[model samples]
Target: MWVLVFFDLPTETRTERKVAARFRKNLLDDGFAMFQFSIYMRFCASRENASVHIRRTKNNLPKKGKVCVMQITDKQFGMMELFHGQKEVEPEQPSQQLELF
Candidate 1:
């Protein structure tokens, strides 16, 4: 399971800038890595784990601007295509899990 967070917060004012920085730091402290300038991603042990992190993200959302959260399976995330100079490249898929039951 993966949790992706996308946010765009107002940063024109000094206080707004501080709020944005604090939000980013919170995401980092929560184990999310920066995928883009304002996008962060994290791998969760399970769907429920992802949900917990998602809730945390919601709680820290900035008072202004837009925010979006998305949950995706490893398989679905693998299908994401990246384009560079007109060439389409699929993202590397995560290794198969070895579950012991």
Candidate 2:
């Protein structure tokens, strides 16, 4: 499972910029990696685990911007095509996650 967070936060003022930076930091601290400037993604062992991160992301959302959270299966994510200029490139692999019972 993958939990993808997309956000567009206001950064017009110093305070707003600080708030946006803090939000990104929180996402990173919670194990999400930057997929784009405004997109962060994390791999989870299960749907339940993905839900937990989604909740955490919701809890940290800024008061003045748009935020969207979505989940995708590994197969769906794999079908995505990435490109740099005119050349195609492979997506970076997600790190292996180990679960202990």
Candidate 3:
């Protein structure tokens, strides 16, 4: 599963900019990578793990902005089409994680 976060936060004021930066930092700290400037995504091992990250994203939402959270299965994510300028490109594959007991 994948947990994706989309946000549009107010950044006209200094404080608002700070808040926006903090939000991005929080997402990065929580294992999300920047899919775009306003979109962050993280791959989870299971739906339950995705739910945990989704809850964390909800907990740190900005005070005055729009935020959207979405979850998609690995197959769905793999079906995405990516392009660079006029040329098509392949989407990145998720990294394999090691589990140790």
Best by TM-score: 3
Please give, for residues 1-101, the per-residue lDDT of candidate 1 as tens digits.
Answer: 88899998999999999999999999999988887899989877799878999999999988898999999998778778778679997764444445587
TM-score of each model, in listed order = 0.81, 0.93, 0.94
Question: What do the candidate models score in CA lDDT, each in turn?
Answer: 0.86, 0.92, 0.92
Candidate ranking (lDDT, best to worst): 3, 2, 1
Stretches of candidate 1 exceeding 4 Å from the true structure: 83-101
TM-score of 2: 0.93
Point out the worst 10-residue segment of candidate 2 by lDDT: 91-100
After superposition, which runs of candidate 3 have C-alpha atoms over 4 Å from their true positions?
99-101
Q: Give the poorly placed runs of model 2, Cα more than 4 Å off.
A: 99-101
lDDT score for residue 70 of model 2: 93
On a 0 to 100 scale, what is the lDDT of residue 14 in model 2?
Answer: 100
Query: Which candidate, 1 or 3, has the higher TM-score?
Result: 3
Give candidates' CA RMSD values in order: 3.8, 1.4, 1.2
| TM-score computed on alpha carbons, candidate 1 | 0.81
Q: How far is candidate 2 from the true structure (C-alpha RMSD, Å)?
A: 1.4
